[model samples]
Target: MKRRQIYFILVLIACNFTLGYAQNPFEVIEEPLPYSKKASSFTINIIGYNEDFVINEWQKYITDFSGLTYVTAVNKGVVEMESSGVVFPLLNDNKVNLYTRFAPNKTLTGVLLTVWVQKSDGTFFSSESSKKEAERIKDWLFEFQDKIRLLNTRIKYQQRF
Candidate 1:
């Protein structure tokens, strides 16, 4: 390959990597609930760079969230609205985004708990607040688990591997 062509390919790859690292403008950066009890409900919001990208990401986000166990429904909408109900306050009012409402009495906790895909530059972002919320939301989860090493019989029984 020509040197110029090789340089172009390298630049493209770097851009993609950077984009993956950047948060999705249309999506909220969420941390997985610390407890996997199942969420009472959750909303996944994704921002769009344009009409086409908005529709495209909305579709992909739904498809991905649907595979999860506790996602009761995926709410789709544009980012232009003053309030995106669930996603607005959390996403800092990005122009394009998507959100999903989780079911009641459930939790999620683990590595890479919440992954937000931002469109501004196709990057990813996360936060401690999101993790704290996930932990808080666990209280509402039906099958939720307590992190504390309680001595109660039930907790002990459940703790046994």
Candidate 2:
């Protein structure tokens, strides 16, 4: 009876661990091309907002960017944005993929936003090419983060008022 009870407890613990791992939304799959091979990725969590709201805001921001043009929703939480023309000599055309994962809980209430860039061929820019274009990508991401922060602040302030 004692051995049986111990085995049962061990099985329960193992099952719990497996379920927790499976439910993690932020687990980055390295085998995927764009996700693991991205030249750069910016991840952030915006509190007090749902996944749909976060995705909508990102869509609006990307559409409003000077060179970026809204293409179409790849899926429910994934959006694809393309450049209007050749933005970089090395990468004739570039594309941005925005992926959002929402996790709402008592402590944290928001979505995880990941921005990835790829070349026209649907692969990450080479290291040499990325070195040349890093500055531009960094600048754009900085501006994008600032806009998100401002939007979050406004939402929180309005909620209080």
Instruction: Tell me the whole-model lDDT of each prediction, alpha carbons only.
Output: 0.33, 0.53
Candidate 2 stretches greater than 4 Å from native: 1-42, 66-108, 126-129, 155-161
Number of colliding residue pairs in model 1: 52
Candidate 1 segments whose C-alpha is farther than 4 A from its true place: 20-23, 29-31, 40-161
Query: Per-residue CA lDDT of candidate 2, range 108-143, in tens?
Result: 566655545555565554334465555455455456
Q: Per-residue lDDT tens digits of candidate 1, residues 1-161?
A: 69999999999999999988764422333343454323222333322123333334333433443322223334342222111212322345333222333222122211111222232343223233344444333332211112111223455698895
TM-score of each: 0.21, 0.45
Q: Please give the lDDT score for candidate 1.
A: 0.33
